[model samples]
Target: MTDTLLPESDAGNTSDAVHEDRLWCDNGWTARVIKNEDDDGWAVEMIKDGEAEPALVGPWTMGRDKKNPKPLDIGAFNTLVKTASEVLRRHEQQLHAQLHKRLTVESGDGSVEVTLDIVPDEDDPYALLTAFDALGEQLAQVKVAPNFKLSRAGAASWVENGFRRPG
Candidate 1:
């Protein structure tokens, strides 16, 4: 796509910088085309501000000669930013799904909603197990190990055991 200069607000406060034919920086992100290490083709990397690694890295298009990489342009940069932002969003969603779980269990009193949320930290990982009565009043909240298993059966057992931490 042809290069299109973005509006000042969209491009942020910094002036757009074109480092080379294959690299451009704008709107707090950098798009760079590099030689593919696995193949003779080219690949593009999109890195956001203050990030040590690229949020997206994928194959790049070849130039008209089919040897050099296609030159970076405003349109290409904008597309790359959109793509890389989507990748980051999906990754965060997946991680949140993995770390948080919810279930409903039938108890003698009524149905209870149970939720297990894990905080995944490199140095200190932990989980919080919480239970709420049918009316949405919290019954109990306990800190558990990060690896604690959460399931319908486990929730039922916890409710039956007076909301005590399961061994």
Candidate 2:
């Protein structure tokens, strides 16, 4: 497939560097200002290298002529890269939180730490329910459905039930 590259501006420097009027490629990312298809205004998209889709897209400021988009400068490109990188970082953090969990509950024996670590397999998604004694000795571990709702009452009940696989 033929790739359509934006015209290089006079600011173009080294082979790996591209500082153009409406396009920039640097720091493993590319920022491009394009006419918004949903509206008459323009939009800016920040895409990481080798990614088919942009990581971030937002409205672009208008130029002095009002009809044209403002040039993509070094400062703007840096800000876009920061914002897009932050977006990806936050997304990864959220996914991690969803896959791992820990909770502490008071059982008749003592305080037990419970954990649920989900394995997001394409065909066999499941979670491991584990219990540990206050001294850090693993009490039991069982494979449960990924959607199992771990709660204080559920954990206490499981501990009280002798740590058999939660049915």
Best by TM-score: 1
Residue by residue across 1-167, what tens digits does model 2's lDDT show?
Answer: 11334335523533576678888887678898999998889999999999999989999999999999998876687789899999989989999999999999998888999999999999999999999999999999999999998998999999999998888
Q: Residues 1-167, candidate 1, lDDT per residue (tens digit)? A: 33565767675544655545787777788898999999999999999989999999999999999999989876777789899999999999999899999999888888899999999889999999999988999999999999999988888998899878888
> How high is the CA lDDT of each candidate model?
0.87, 0.87
Instruction: Please report, as a residue range, the 10-residue window in candidate 1 with the lowest summed lDDT.
Output: 11-20
